[model samples]
Target: METVDLVVPVKSLTAAKSRLRGAADHGVGDPKAHARLALALVLDTVTAALAARRVRRLLVITSDPTVSLEVAAVGVPVAPDTPGGGLNPALERGAHLLRQNDPCAAVGALQADLPALRPAELDAAIERAAAIFAAGPAPRAYCADAAGEGTTLLLCAPGSALQPCFGTDSAAHHERSGAYPLQGDWPGLRRDVDTGEDLRRAADLGVGPRTREVLAPCPHP
Candidate 1:
């Protein structure tokens, strides 16, 4: 079982989760409150990733110094989004750094808003990805988001190009780019909080302590 280097990209707190603002009247109307929720989500995601036994290294790429400080509290190294392109570019930069440090290490990009992510679920997904990598021919693979339309996780074997296409309909895009879709019953791995509805679903599935603490004050409609 080869260790995986996981790259997580987070936007500035003020710019995070804009689409989730008024979703289902979740009471995250205040900008400050929204930033707090966003940070909490990232904290939980990083916490789960750190707990995953298969993840040898976890790197967070972001331009926000505030986010860097927060992630550092959890012992995860933060890298500046020097590429400054977007989500994909940030991921590429992190992957590049990991490869430079250890060219033979497998690298993968994971979404940063998965408050409901479980360590066991992430380990399972990585195990499946490792199997695919070992099978040969296919060098990359992705796990669909909860909606089954977007990509929540994307991986490339060591020395392989990590072509991350994470955006609208990203699942289709990654598949088109030769990344196999992993099939499994990994509910936590699939759940990436975006809209208000998605947040509610994650709440139902049980979120991490950080997310639960932040959402406790805000009443959902």
Candidate 2:
């Protein structure tokens, strides 16, 4: 089976998940609680990605001190988002680093907000992506978020650049850049949390243990 390396970029806790901060009663007015939630999201995302059979290696690109410490503790490699420009730069740096070590392996950029990510869904997407790569022409592909406006995963075949354009309408941006759109029923992988509604949806789909634990005591928003 062809496996791939994945780069997951995480923002500092203080700057992460602004839209979700007050969306849940878990941490509506508490910075500490909000940070915990943000950290839990990253941990869950990392855990799920690592569990995917097609994932050969996963690197976390982050400058957040707490995130760096936590992810390292779990045995996932950590690299500083040295460029510090934005999401794309951070992803590019991590992809470049991974390519340096394993030039033949495909590299991918994944979002850090997918607390409900499923290992099988990710494996299925990568399996499909491998087929696309073998077909040739476009060496990049992306999985759109649930709304189909944003991107949750961007993949680049060996020798292709991971030029991530993550922001508003990122799914359209990726497609315009010649990345084939991945089609599947990967609800857990596509349902990245941003709002209270998004969280509710993730809960319905079943979140990872860390996220579930954090929300266990909080009232449903």
Candidate 3:
């Protein structure tokens, strides 16, 4: 079992998930409320990633001190978003750090908003990715989001370029760059909460404790 280093990028809670605010007919309109929800989503994501068997090390890249403190409490390493070039740069920085630490390790980038992500599903995805690299022609692979238009996960084999093209129809961009698309029934892995509707869908799929706790008082609209 080749352990895959998973890099999760989280923006400052205050600035994150802006789209989800007021996205629902009864969505949380308060900025503070949105920040709380965003933090819960990230916490749940980190928790699940920590439990995945195929994950060798889970690193969170963020520029926020509060996020650093929160994730550090969970025993996951926190890296500063040094490049500060946005999502793709943050991921690349994390990957570069991981590779520097362990040159032979496979690396992957995952979104930090998957509140419903289950450990088993992540394990299965990593196993399939490993098999792909082993049977190889392509050096990169990605898992599509539930909408099938965005990419939720992207991976690169050891020694391969972590050319992450994540943002605005990233699924197509990744595929166009020659990263193979990993298809399967990974609903939990695909369900990234963005809109109020997305949060509701993840709730239907049963989100993790943190997300459930945050959303308990504020029901889906």
Candidate 4:
């Protein structure tokens, strides 16, 4: 199976994870704490994605200086979110750049909030997608979020355009756009944290160390 170059888009901390604001152990109205949680989620997600054997390179798209710095420290390239529109546009920019660098490599867009991501699960999903691609003319494939409504991962084979439609009901949107749906038993790959409850579910799945650090209680003054 051909390896993939994954593009992860992260919103600036100031505007990221709004729904998580009042979540227990996730800041609860504290802006600074909220940003830390947001950053932790992205870092964990990136770390796991990079560890996947099927992943050749990972690029993080964001305009936040702190995010750029943190991700760069891990040896992942950072690109500015030039479009400044929304998720899809940022993903498109990342995908375009990756394709420009190596047109033969598959390009994938992954959500930045999957703090519990497991590299093996991601590799299995990508392998499944590769099998489907080899069998037919399908150019794209997507893995649904845990709720089966949103899309957590969208992939396009070499020379295929990654026309992502990631938003509400994005799983269905990607299907309507002709992307095949991958049926992989990957709980960690699907669990993306959005609300307090989502965080709880991810915790149940055993989040990465970075996320665990953020969720750990602060020391008494």
Model 2 TM-score on a 0 to 1 scale: 0.96
lDDT of 1 by residue, 1-221 (tens): 47799999999988888977754236537777778788888999999999999999999999888899999988999999864588888898899898886888899999999989999988898889889888985889999998889988998888888999999999999999999999888888899988888888899889899888877765462
TM-score of each: 0.95, 0.96, 0.95, 0.95
For residues 126-195, could you state the per-residue lDDT of candidate 3 as single tens digits? 8888888889868899999999999889989988988999999999999999999998899999999888
Model 4 residue 101 CA deviation (Å) reads 2.2
Where does candidate 2 have its weakest 10-residue lDDT segment?
A: 22-31
Off by over 4 Å in 3: 22-28
Residue pairs that clash (backbone atoms under 3 angstroms), model 3: none
Stretches of candidate 2 off by over 4 Å are 24-27
Q: What is the C-alpha lDDT of each candidate?
A: 0.87, 0.89, 0.88, 0.89
- lDDT by residue for model 2 (151-184), tens: 9999988888888989999999999999999999
Worst 10 residues of 1 by lDDT: 21-30
**Root-mean-square deviation of each candidate, in angstroms?**
1.7, 1.4, 1.7, 2.5
lDDT of 4 by residue, 1-221 (tens): 47999999988998998998855343457888888889999999999999999999899999999999999999999999874588888898899899886878899999999999999999999999999899985889999998999999999988898999998899999999999999979999999999888888898889899888878783210
Local distance difference test, candidate 3 = 0.88
